[model samples]
Target chain A: MKASPMVEIKNLKKWFPMKSGFKSKSNLKAVDGVDLHIYGGETLGLVGESGCGKTTIGRTLIKIYEPTDGEFLYRGGDSSEGGVDIFSLSESKMRPFRREIQMVFQDPYASLNPRITVHDIISEGLRVHSMGKSREERKSMIAGILEKVGLRPEYMYRYPHEFSGGQRQRIGIARSMILNPGLVICDEPVSALDVSVQAQVINLLEDLKHDFGLTYLFIAHDLAVVKHICDRISVMYLGRIVETAETDQLFDNPLHPYTSGLLSSIPVPNPHMRKIGKREIVKGDIPSPVDPPETCRFVKRCPRAFDRCCKESPSLREVSDGHFVSCFLYD
Target chain B: MPKFFYKRKLDEIEEKARPVHINSYRQLVWTKFKSHKLALFGAVVLIGVAFFTLLGPLFVEVGYEDMDFSNLFSPPLTEGHPFGTDELGHDVLVRVMYGGRISLFVGFASAVITTLIGTIVGLLSGFYGGIVDRLLMRFVDVMLSIPMFPILITLTLVFGSGIMNIILVLTVFGWMGVSRLVRGLVLSIRETEYVMSARAMGVRNGRIILRHVLPNVIPIVIVSATLNMSYAILAESSLSYLGLGIQPPMPSWGNMLQRAMNYILGTTTGTNPWWLTVFPGFFIFITVLNVNFLGDGLRDALDPKFVSES
Candidate 1:
């Protein structure tokens, strides 16, 4: 791993204000004070239940949804000194970085435009950036990228409707990869695919990451899928990250109760082994993010919650050589 | 027989193995449109009518105003009077052709103006979507709430009916529907993932609206414009029928119909000259009906969900 992080998010916050009454207002804190570092050439998996702000983190990083507060430091090539604070830059100033950070959307059907052909969809970024000199040159470039993404070059002329879900996803991957981005945010890329087709898309992503020397922030609810592709994994609850560690270390010795509960919920294939394995199912629905109490978010759901867990929120702290946890039990 | 069958089977396999031919967006729409038999028939009839009105006047010797005292009120199939003559000895054939030119021009010009205003308003209103949306929508509501026919009549009366003034009145009353349709479409399309993806690529707002958002709204605009053309033609006819549209000396399908009413009631020559009334009314009916069919075909063909079988 590189000595310095490629992207560092510090105290990131994204709150959506709601109109509770004519005069009264409340906020839904989708991502509240999230701090993360994504090193170059490593896949960092972000796993959480639905509406835990995993997708919000990814979107804010790409500036799709502007951060309410915080510094998003991005260290490009040769910028070892302090990096550029992406959140502070204006949109025009952020143009070059948009080419460097691309995203693979969750829904393949919705991501690709139906009116245009695959050639137009893939070449859109290139045209915006003025990467190719001529139309013919851009066509050849698109054809080449299509081949790289495991799609036939001839499919470039076809409309998006002609393709299956898996094929459309491959096209989405091609769209992001054509720019040769440094960080590719995969937001539930395979969650919408059939079980039989999920592994195929995951393998394609893994293969492309290796080929391009790309880093990824893989956001998914499936731990099994993330386990196969991620080097490190971060578990989040509500708007805060509860734990993060090396993939093997985090799986072997789960620090947070939430992490342990998540691992236990993954159904074992062996019928006999299921009886031996202990289940630690966390109780109750995830609390509403709107006007949440200023205490640990997991207190109500945590089976191991005690007095200290309710009185105050726990900040993420390094507990071992590399593993970090935010639970009061770790303290 | 076995050898011949074997050879044919091999050829069939080769044919099946060939690659699928890719069609562009335009080609797909064209193919889908071509398959609708009524639309195709309508398109052909419309094209013929347009050409006749536009070019037939150049070839005809008699002008619409030319009056023949000896041939006044002559019936059809008479010498040099295939469509016969009106009460004033004006050739009905020449007048109908000349009226077509005015009616078709008004329809097309008014449709173009309405589409332009509607699309711009809708794009700006939907894309910006805060104060702009509220203000524009309220204005559209105000415009829509006003009874259109009465306002059109009042405006035509005030403006003093000429071709330009009638078109201006029609355009003012006509654009609200298209603007409302386009605004509704744009509101949904603005939230679509493809549009978000385009914005994330750092494409400028203007470029995104034009390239990504506008293309999706185009099908609705096309359908609306076609409907508007028919509406404009009908409105002009009605206005002219009441003596508040394209004044006499200038032939329009509307005034010609009005002129034929005299012969129908036998107020002028005591003879019901069916040719005068039939020709002008027929042209108006044919043009409006065919234009509507073309619009219906376009709506189906341009739908993204529409799957062309082959």
Candidate 2:
């Protein structure tokens, strides 16, 4: 938690030009004007509704999709200028960046390649980056990484089909961590898992982070899960970060109206604690990202939206130390 | 001590272990495949015969080159002779094995080359979809519609004979049907959440196709490929029969049968041997049937869709 920042994004925007109708071309903004910092040894829990650009932000940070506009800074980890603007470099220069900042994808079932043996899947990153020297050395290193991920070494020869969902996730985690990357974007790492298995994975990730001194950009829609692991949290609304703060601060005293509503809506265990439900309910469905609103992306459904909120798009700004919010009410 | 040793070994193995299934599809399909004794036997026998036929001639000193006129038409299993001698008195069984070399090579090699080309192109075209899919499929359809034989004939007529030429034609034109089959495979496998998960993992498009989509289609390609080789052998035989395939002195079964047809009729009618046509035809039937049987076994073993209700 005391370590310096490892990754930085400045006004990153990712727009997809998807032409759906037989007649017209439509442009959709999947991740627009989002900026956040991930410090080494810290987990940045990015929570939001489905289709709220959580995945997009994670991807943009990883350089899978080129940010349509903005600068991505990577420092002191995987060789991209030790805090260099990642988006500025060509793909040839991005190789080490990819190796250093790996991704533990959301779906364990799909993240690993089914055709390849678990050994090969784990070693593929090593091969591409020329990490380990000999085949035997790579095998040993892969075995070691697999063990670190709580999988037995012999699983190296087995195909992806041989593993259960939890084991498959461990394989995915192993594949990402095989390179011993400093930053791993765990995109909803345990969302696809059974409820009982989620805690085990969370524990495993915590152990791995402590052991390896790894940083995680943990993305999820479940507020409770994110609260469990994330030191700092960010809530997104339609491709924009609505609010960001430390976990305790956000839950204890939510500044953004949306954050407060999300917390109040979480099912409390005690039925006796029930006051008349003054919990703010989000009305209306998520609007299509295509040709989104020019002003506040969530103004139509925001409880505190005013005349100014409708006319102007709020920029992400520091409302307090280590806390940021993008809303005219905060302004 | 042994048990402890084994337990430690098992524990170490388990640490680097795969999640094992207590009950699996193994007992089912594996038994089914083995039960296909004819197919299983065919695979083993054909593999053995093919190994000898293909690799045997390379090692042997005297080939179809050595001619013995006095030994010509010697009845099979004669003194110090087996399967008799031909008109030139060349060793018949040796020539037959050598002939199998050429026939099996042209068949299997062409089929493999064709199937690889088809599956790769089809997987990319179908999985990506849109204008690419339309164009590629249409091209495949056009290639399929054209009479494969005439085109092959024209190609052979232009390119001439030998194993290389035959493999070239088969690879170039033989991919059409396989491409269609692979396109269907890709179309379905692409829908699996696993593939989408790969894309989400930041895996590149090429890597996703090769790693995620291609392996599932391998069983289909493997089965279809063996069958295609059988067809390829027949095509080559027909070419040889028409005097367009492997030129004489190369010792193809088709040319041998062609040369022996007159003698076979003569043996039935007059004094020449009737075994000529019978021998070549027998070899051809056996080779095709064996390859088909192997393919059937593979299909039964690998295809999840073909799981027999036990």
Candidate 3:
């Protein structure tokens, strides 16, 4: 990255307790020992299969869920800044930290409030963090942001119910960007949307990044969508990053068998890369987060597993200058 | 499974012409409700009775408790009194109208207050989901354990009977059930993606609870409040009938019933004079029913949980 690292994840772990009513919970490691660097003005895509803990990683980095163990450092120098190990800070201390980071969620239908007018929905972040000094300032700022997201200023008075799904997702974007956050986690932002609208939103995101100098940890399962937008991509499996490489490098020659399998599975019409007669069909569902294997998690599904793979959980080693992978094959 | 399948098919056929938003829930309910022949008749009868009772007495001169012993029991359609005189010689028509106003007032007032209080408590408890929830829900549980009749009687015995006092008690405990309702609503709504987005935006607790959570709970609250009004009105009348609700001279619907009970019992209560009990009883029934219809229609119109009307 040309720019400095805006956010750093150092051995981050998030374990959710598996419990029922009045029952003691067993620890379930949802995000286990994830280390990553997201630099300023860069989009880092965290791609994974379902339940691979990509979403958990996003939530934990923002302190929505405290890490079980690890350090999350913010770039600010404020009293609430510079990585006091967010898990140790009081909730009030975490308040101002919220202004720096925001999230745009998947499911546009579920992300923008139905009862709220587009105005209140968009202006909410501005009002909460005390961004604008006066009502007119807030209004103009809200209108400006709405227009930035491809919405008419007049539609501010209308409730969310009046808008289409894509429009609502735009409003959701407007709400998050009203504060012009430094870091925004777009969690599967286009999955719920139709294919055509997806391109518009992705383009909007790209334009917004250029305008606002934003950094993103775009989490999604579809590598095809993430391929163009992300500067670097980390492919995860069962709560751990299996491979990390620059987007082009990862796409051109995926080394990890899991990454290779994921890339091979993409139903694209690329003629040259086509393996018409061969498909890497991964066996078995993702292993449960509860009581994960002591060895390499990919061992069970790996077609290339060996004796050493069963005895050791591979460390994320730098295979090339910036490329990292966690596989015995690399060692 | 087949029954559900057939019903689902019928719903699909009905849903075909329906708009995507409305077709899912609101329109389906509305079309089904509209098709119900008896509910429609009940709805009309209810509206007519409420219109005449609630609006009819606004034109009369006599006060609700006005008395003139000389004209007592002069019979129905009598001159100077269309509904004739009661045992107290008061104009029964005027009395029932005013009583209707009072009954509707108490019922509506109690229901509204209850819904508001319940919604606030519910949102806080359900959305917060920790010590706050524990304390607030424990309070609700404590309130719920108290028996309705005994509490009303004790309150009447201790604080004395009047409209405001009765409304206060009704609202106090009336909020319990709807609190549970709204809490359940907020529980579901808080987990919704919109709420998550709001939280991610650094939106404060109060704004999220009010804007995102509260609106989602409106359908449930409206439906519950509408039902609660019927209960409130019935409870008030029952209290008055037991001589503990509105004291003598206020002439509540329940007090009206209490006075007419003797006459009905003495005359087998089936005689044409039965209009006394019948009219007041009919007013209570219709007011409750109309409030229900209003709730139903509002549910169809404003409920967001129901699929958007295509």
Candidate 4:
């Protein structure tokens, strides 16, 4: 592992102002004060339920949605001392950084523009960044990338609608990878694919990561898929990271109550072991993120809630080597 | 599964299956448009009419101002007067051909101007939502609320009636509908994932609007422009009928109709000059109808989901 992290997020906040009625305004704290680090050449899976600000974090990191507050520092390659804060950079100043970071979207169908051919879609980034010198050079580069992503080079001239879900996903992958970005924010890339196709895409992604030496902030809701690909995992609940550990360590000895509950919900493949395995399903709906109380976000849904869980929120603390948890039980 | 054998077989199969030519976006739209039979017919008819009117004047020797008092009220096929002569002994065929030039010019020019203004305003308003959108939409609403014909008449009267002044008046009121339509379309398109993806790629805002949003908007703008052209023609006709558009001897289709209406109740000779009114009115009707058909065809052809086979 490298001594320095490739990217470090410090106290990130993204609050969207909501209009309730006339003369009253409140903010929905979508991603409130998230602190994280993504090291070089490793997939860090961000596992969370729907609307837990997982996608928001990914978007904010790439400057898709500007952060309400905090620092997003990108330290490219081995030399880490001279990294710039992404949040403070102006749009023109940030253009070059955009070439270094790319994203694969959730929906394959919606991601590619319908009117344009696959060649145009893949070449868009190259055109913007002025990667290839000439049109023919860009065409060859696009063809090469298409083959790398497992799509035929001949498929470049076809429109997006001509392809199936899996093929379109490959095109989406090709589009992002063509830029040779250092860090890829794969925001639910496989969530919208078929169960059978998911494995293929996952393997493709894994192969590409090794081939390109790319780091990934893999945001997903599926723990099983995340465990397969991610080197380390971070469990988020309501815009806050509750636990961070190695994939096997997090799954085998889950520390936070929320993390354990998530792990238990994954169905076991063996019927014989199912009866023996205990399911610690948490109770109650996720609390509204709009002006949430200062108490622990998981207190209402925690299976082992205590007096301290309601009165005060617990910040993440290291309990074991390479494992951190936020629940008061560990404290 | 040997590498050489597998690669050779795959290459052979791919070569056999590959299409000979790749279709560009324009080619696809043209192919789809050609499939719509009615629109194709309309296009042919419109082209024929345009060519005849625009070029027919060159062949005809009779000028619009050349009045023959001796050949007054002469019906169709009467030496040198094929369609007929009007109360002023002016050749109706020459007059109709000349008038078409004015009417068609007004329609095409106004449509182009309105579409340009509407598209620019709508693109800006829709892409930059918030105060800009609210302010633009409200201004559109204010423009829409004003009575169209009354303002058109007032403006025409103020500017003095001519081809340019009438077109100017029509354009001022005409752009509002197209802007509203384009804004609605842009609002939806701006939220699409492709646009967001483009933004994430750090494609500049102007480039995104032009390359991404504008292409999607063009189909709608084209259809609306066709509709606007027909509307402009009719508006011109109505204003001229009321003696407020394209005044007198310059002979527009509208003013021609205005002059024909004077002889509808029969002239001093007790002869009904129905030929005078029928020819100009028929031209207007055909032009508008075909323009509409062309618009309908374009809408279907431009739709990305429209299957050419269907």
Candidate 5:
């Protein structure tokens, strides 16, 4: 991999301040610390259960929520080497980068403005960036993108509510990709659609990814969906990345106990195979992110926890050529 | 999933060949609004009343202030007076028509002023959020706490009785409700993902509020403005009846009502001067009723939930 990565985030943290009058202020550490590197045209899957902070990572990386701590870097082209430190850039200075990095929100219903037409929704980015020469040129560009996203150009005139869930997701994808963004942060884009429509959207995304050389931070809770599209996978526990590796490698041999437990939870089609395969059942609820314990965040629910795991948290370390894990077992 | 792939390939080919059609949110809203029967009726009534008030006086031969002593105390269908004459022999029809102009002007002017101020305050407070929000909301609270009529009375006394002064008083107090209304709406709207998307697009704060937010809030603003008109008209009438708004020789509906009371009490020349009271009271009633109807219709038309339901 001689080509410089598109985005490199090191020890990224986003903490929300909870303070009201007389009560003492405390930070809710959503994305405590995450290190990730995404190559030019690969979909990096970020998997975690609800409230595990996968969404926050995507948002913080996009500068929607300012990074509380750490550095986010973006290398624009092949030879223009040294990556731009996005985390440190002022809002005005960050404008050009925002054009390169766009996001597709989860709920299609909530994401696209109901008051806006599909044409406006898809072309808003172009308008914001002041792209194209005229309205006619923009319309033609939008029409072409609409067709590529599996939506007819005619549908561009319609409002969001007029479209089906699958269609709305296609519109959302078009909106994000209209700028020909280098890196797109897909925040559970298909999670709100019906099960039947999910596969169509997923295929559309995959086709779009191949058609245009686009990188993505695909965040979702379902490992099954992530496996189909993501080349590399990063599993999150609480507010930290516990394990990361190539998709096939992560699936076959999960390094962290938390990752293994997550893999086991995915149901097998054959009942006989299900019984034969050992399922890891760990107990206890996920601890509160606000004032998290000093030990490993997943230690309470980890079946393989020991005395060392209870006292000191393990930072992520490269256990193999490409695989990284954050646990005492890896140490 | 495999079945979806096989089925969708054929649909995609056919779908792509289709021509584009133009549509817009404005068109959709207009279509939705047009379907509401009562809203259409209200619009018609409003237009009719406004037309009559604005231009009806041009066709009438009698002057509002022309006092014909020979026609004093004359009933309806008199030689020259069709609607009849008041105790002062003024044409009741002409006076009501003239009063409508003043009354409608005061209502609309005050409502427009109030809506503008309220919207600006709400946008500033709600979009900026922190201390600006607190300060503006507290001001609204303080404004709301003042007894409107009594303060208006005291202020009118200090300022002297005039049309502009009454409008100013109404506008000062009227804006609080609308500001609170707009602030509450903006608070919820600001949290929505569309607004977030706009921010992520690097749209300036002012542009976001104007383009993304203001359109969403316009329907509600319009509804409040229409309702505010009724409040303004009623307030002006009350002030005028109290001998404060649109003073003597000006012929406001409120001052007309004040003079009508004299006829009602048998203190004036006429034994029965019902036209003096009836026409002014009727015009006020009609104007307020139509405005309320328009407000109700606008509320239904503007409501997204209502549009979906229908």
Candidate 6:
């Protein structure tokens, strides 16, 4: 924790304004208040159920959705500036920093520009950043990065429609990594690919991470895939981070009731274990994010919730070394 | 330093040695378009008709405005005139060919103007998607609600009837449909991941729209443009029939058709001069039909789902 963090997000909030009748407005608190740090060259997995704002956190960090409040900082490899206050910087001023941080989108089908050739799609980042001296240099760089991401060099000549789901994801990966960004936010990079191809893409990502010295904020709803690639894990519920811990530590000892419920839901493969294991399935649809209550967001859904859980909200508290949880049980 | 930053000499050498697969997206779309038999036929018809409209008049010696009182209502293959002469003794072939130029010009000019204005407005409205979208889309709705024909007639009356005025009026009314169409496309394109990824990569907003959003919308634009041209021609013809478009001494298929209307009663009497109405009316029909066919072909060829599914 003492080592200088590569990216630090402090109580970042993003609320989308919704029109409510005439002359009134409401806020959908997609990412209310989130705080986390990703160290250099580490893969931090942001995990939550489908509407829990995991994607919002990744987007907010990349400045896709401007932060509503709080400080967001990025410790650039060039340490002389200390840390750039990303949220404070104007969009024009933030442009240069964008080249240092890129994103690999979730849906490979929708990620690559279908109208463009694979070369243009992958090299678009390079062309935008004005990375190389000439178009030829960028072409060479694209070919090199394409090969690095496990695609053939000549494949760049083809359009996205010509490739399968896995090949398209590789093209998406090459695009993000082409600029050699310090932080690459992979928003469910393999969720759209086949199970067999998912492992190949995951392994390719791991290989690229080492070869490029890239740090990642991998967002996924699936715990098993997150476990395979992420070094650390942060669990989110509603619009807040309920727990954050080392991946193995969080799996071994889940502090929050929500975390335990999530872990218990993972289907055990063995027949005997499946028969004997009692699955913890929470009931009821997630409450609306519009004007959420002051109490714990998960109170109505938490199986172990008590009187105090209804009255107060829990802040993320360090229960053990590098293990943090937001439940009153931990406190 | 990471190996990707600086290109290795070996990598460059290997790049040159590798088997090159140079299949560009333009080539792919073209190849697909070529495979569509109907689209190919439509393309040929469109090109052939356009060429005839442009150059067919040059080969004929008789002027469209020249009148020969002695040759009035002459049938086809008459001396010193081909395709016969009209009731006014004007050469039907020359007038029809000349009308093609004006009709085709008005169609294309208005379509281009509409597409340009519509693309800009739609891109701005859809990409920004806030008050701008609300204002532009509402304006489109207002435009859509008005009776276009009445407004066009009123505008042409105020503006004076001429080819440019007709083009301007048609353009003013025509752009709304394209804007609405482009706006719808942009709304979806703006949400796609590549756009967000482009935004995250430090690409300027304008570049994202041009490079990512516009290219995706081009196929739709092409198809719409062809359809728009046919609509423009039809509108121009209707206006001319009402005497609000393309005045006399000038040849427009619309005005020519209006002139032909005078000869329709001749048919009831069994004395009809079929050359006047049939030839101009036939040209209008064939031109519109061919353009529409081309539009249909483009829509099929450019549909990404159609391409991938096949």
Provide a comma-separated list of chain B TM-scores, one per candidate: 0.83, 0.76, 0.77, 0.87, 0.82, 0.85
Name the top TM-score candidate.
6
- Per-residue CA lDDT of model 4 for A12-112, tens digit only, reads 99999999889578889999888788899999999999999999998888887879999988987543585889999999988978888889999998888
TM-score of 6: 0.92
Model 6 lDDT tens row, A186-288: 8888889889999999999899889878898999988999999999999999999999999999998888888988998898888776745456677787889
| TM-score per candidate | 0.89, 0.73, 0.84, 0.91, 0.90, 0.92
Off by over 4 Å in 5: A2-4, B1-37, B68-79, B146-154, B258-277, B292-310
Per-prediction DockQ comes to 0.24, 0.15, 0.23, 0.33, 0.29, 0.51
Residues A272-306 of candidate 5 have per-residue lDDT tens digits of 77855488965777788987878999988988999
Candidate 6 docking class: medium
Global CA lDDT of candidate 5, please? 0.82
> What TM-score does chain A of model 3 get?
0.93
> Taking the tens digit of each residue's C-alpha lDDT, what string does model 1 give over B90-154?
88888888999999999999999999999999999998898999999899889878886687677
Candidate 3 per-residue lDDT over residues A1-331, each given as its tens digit:
5545677778988998777678676779899999888887789999989998998888777766767898876675333445455556666777666777888888888777776667777777777777777766666676677678898666666667778889988988888887767788899999888989999999999999888788899999877789979999999988888899899999987879899888888886778867786667688889888968789999989989999999989989999978999999989
Which structure is stronger by TM-score: 4 or 5? 4
Candidate number achieving the greatest DockQ relative to the actual structure: 6
Q: List the candidate 2 regions with Cα displacement exceeding 4 Å.
A: A1-4, A77-82, A130-143, A303-309, B1-39, B45-106, B119-168, B180-217, B233-289, B296-310
Please give, for residues B1-310, the per-residue lDDT of candidate 3 as tens digits.
Answer: 0010111222332243334332434454666556555446656876676686678876877876787677777677888888778777788888888787788788879988998898888888899998999999999999989887887788888988889988998888789888888888888888888877777666778878777787778877888988998999888877787767887777777778877877875453344466578777877877788778767766655644334333
* Native-referenced Cα lDDT, model 2: 0.77
Q: In terms of docking quality, how is candidate 4 classified?
A: acceptable
Query: How accurate locally is residue A113 in candidate 2, as Cα lDDT from 0 to 100?
Result: 60
Q: Order the candidates by DockQ, highest first — what do you get? A: 6, 4, 5, 1, 3, 2
Q: Rank by lDDT, highest first.
A: 4, 1, 6, 5, 3, 2
How does chain A of every candidate compare to the true chain A by TM-score?
Answer: 0.98, 0.95, 0.93, 0.97, 0.96, 0.96
True contacts kept of each: 0.34, 0.19, 0.42, 0.34, 0.27, 0.59
